[model samples]
Target: MAPKVLIVLTSQATISSVDKPTGWYLPEFAHPYYKLAGKCDITIASPAGGEAPLDQGSVKMFEGDEECQKFLKEESSLWKKTEKLESFKGKASQFDAIFYVGGHGPMFDLANSAISHDIIREFYESSKVVSAVCHGPAALVNAKLSDGSYLIAGQQVTGFSNTEEDQVGMSKAMPFMLETDLKKNSGSDSLFVAAAEPWGSKVVVSGKNGKLITGQNPASAGPVGEALLQALGA
Candidate 1:
């Protein structure tokens, strides 16, 4: 049977702290979704359960990309109606992996969601892949295991970096810097690595058997998906 994957999206429609509208980054979701489309069984889910908002800025930014445009036109329904995160509680055995898609939106909702934490913990403890990209690692910052250790502690990981956030002029607006936070929770500074340049693709896979995966930015989405597939042996 094909591996079952759960793709988690943020329901936050706006970065209320900055009063800027934001949601899941289109390319982050689209690229990974397309990469795993035929290779795995996928499910779309979110904190709010319906109409997970889209970051309009991303749509315009990637408008020149053919595949991204096609995703917008053909996959509207996927993001329009998402299953609530709560519904997946205790159902970790049903999935081979859990992926978090990023946007500034996740910094507000998924990052602090108790439900999301529980779901992630369950998946990790179940020996299933736990993955996220860009600001998506916000979801991992506080995720802990039963023994009370941060899941990414001492485990190599990467996410939206301080440089990228500054370049985007959202450093001050973000609740906390992803790179710094990830490294802090990782119990060391060296565990988190960023790309050599802003917006460059960087994916990190680390675990006893490479089950914890993360991508550095939107540019790393497809690679992150590929990494997840490889980790799953799919």
Candidate 2:
């Protein structure tokens, strides 16, 4: 059988009083989906059983791209009806890798989700390729390894940075900044653009062991997806 890749999404429905639109960032999910769909069986899961929230900004950012628009309009059913993390009956060992898709919603809910944290820890402990992008890394803040250490300790990683957050004007509203939390956790070498705006930027992947890939923003989705595929040897 082909290697299986589990793609986890946040089911968070709201962010700072704004209702989360349904679905995920088109490029973030679609780029990876197109790349991996042919090479591996992909399973989509979320914190809640039903529809996951999509970022409206993402939709607008990629609206001019026809392929992405098609993904949002016609090819988003699997993600729309993703299984709840708690209801996932498969063992973590069944999958060869895991990728966490991010949007603003993740910052609100993914970190607090026990099941999501467990899934991440399971993949990490098993030495599977573990990846996350943007605010998706928020989930890692609470993930602990078997030795009771944060999984990100000493890991050179990047996510939606505090600088990017300020660029997007959401830094003040977010419960906590990902960069600050990552530094507080175990990510000592977290990096991001200090002056660039946050809509889209290059993805960052570091550490050869256990594959920890993180994208700075939506622009990094395709590269991040390719990186994950390369890591999986798919």
Candidate 3:
């Protein structure tokens, strides 16, 4: 049987200051979707049950990649039909792994949502792979285990770096900076970063208790997807 992976996308449809439409980055999800969908049974879910917003930048970023472009054209149906977080009811043990696709939206909602935190905790407690990219790692800051300690405590991880945020020109506009928050989380053993630019960085997977895979930015999505598949043995 093919391993089953649950993909969680940010449901926030608008950017903070500008109020521009934004959700999950297309390349962040598309690169992973194409790679994993072929080898595993993949299911999509979101905080809310309706349509997921797509980051306009990603459409241009992965434009030359035919598979990504094809997926983007059909993303409305593909992501809109996602299972609601409430439907999962924090029961994350049923899947082999859970991946969070990121965009500017995650900084606003993913960490603050009780449902998302619970889902992440459940997956971690079950020893399932927990993967995220870019701002997606924001979701981990609040994930608490049954004992009330952060699941990421003492675990090495990565996420969208402050350097990249500045490059994107959204540093001051973001709700909370991810790098600063992660460092303050008290449980993060150590955090890693690519030596190159955030977008050009590769994925980082740490074997801490379970599996924690993280990508630096949109450009790292393909590598992140490939890492997730390897972690699942898919």
Candidate 4:
């Protein structure tokens, strides 16, 4: 059987109490979707399991892109029929890898979901590939391993940086600074591998012995997916 990948999206549609309409970044999800679609068996899931919200800013940002247009035209069941993460607990060992697609909304949901932490811990502890991009890193930063160390501890990882957050005027809007959280949560034995430039297309592949792949922003989404495929030897 082909390797199976679980793509988890945020169920919340707004950015915490900010009252701003937000959810998964379209390109962050779409770019990787197209890249991995036929290559592996993929399942899209969320905390609630249906109607994942779209961050309008991201939709507008990529509105003219061909892949985004195609994804919007169909709005397939893959996006509409996501399964609840709790349902995957029994099958966690069965998944070959997992991907967390991000947007501003994840700060409010996926990042805080106990279910999210459990799933990441499951995949990471199993040594199966674990990947995330953009704000998606929020989901993995707090995941505690069996040893109680952060999953990103000692791993080369990248996510939305402070500069990027400020550049987008979301520095204060977010409940917590993502980059700082990653480093702060980095174990005493490990720290984050910082990216040189804010918007640079960078994907940090840590865990050569363990599989943890993370990308900095939307620009890094495609590369992240490619890296996951490489990690899987696809």
Best by TM-score: 1
For candidate 3, what is the lDDT? 0.80
lDDT of 4 by residue, 29-102 (tens): 98888888888999999889888887778878998899888987775677788998889875778889999998
Predictions in order: lDDT: 0.93, 0.75, 0.80, 0.84
lDDT of 2 at 25: 60
Model 2 lDDT-worst window of ten: 187-196
Of 2 and 4, the candidate ranking higher by TM-score:
4
Positional deviation of 105 in candidate 4, in angstroms?
1.4
Q: Write the per-residue lDDT of candidate 2 for residues 134-197, one digit (tens) a residue.
A: 7778877778877888877777666787777888777767878988888777645443322155
Candidate achieving the largest lDDT: 1
What tens-digit string does per-residue lDDT give for candidate 1 at 65-104?
8889999999999999999999999999999999999999
| Candidate no. 2 TM-score | 0.89
Per-residue alpha-carbon lDDT of candidate 3 for residues 1-234, written as tens digits (9 for 90 to 100): 898898899888887588677788888888888889779988888888677777877777778988778887765687878889777765676798899998988888898889888888778778889999888998886688899987666666678888888988888888888877776663543555554655576677774644888888877888888998888888
The local distance difference test score of model 4 is 0.84
Against the true structure, what is each candidate's TM-score? 0.98, 0.89, 0.92, 0.94
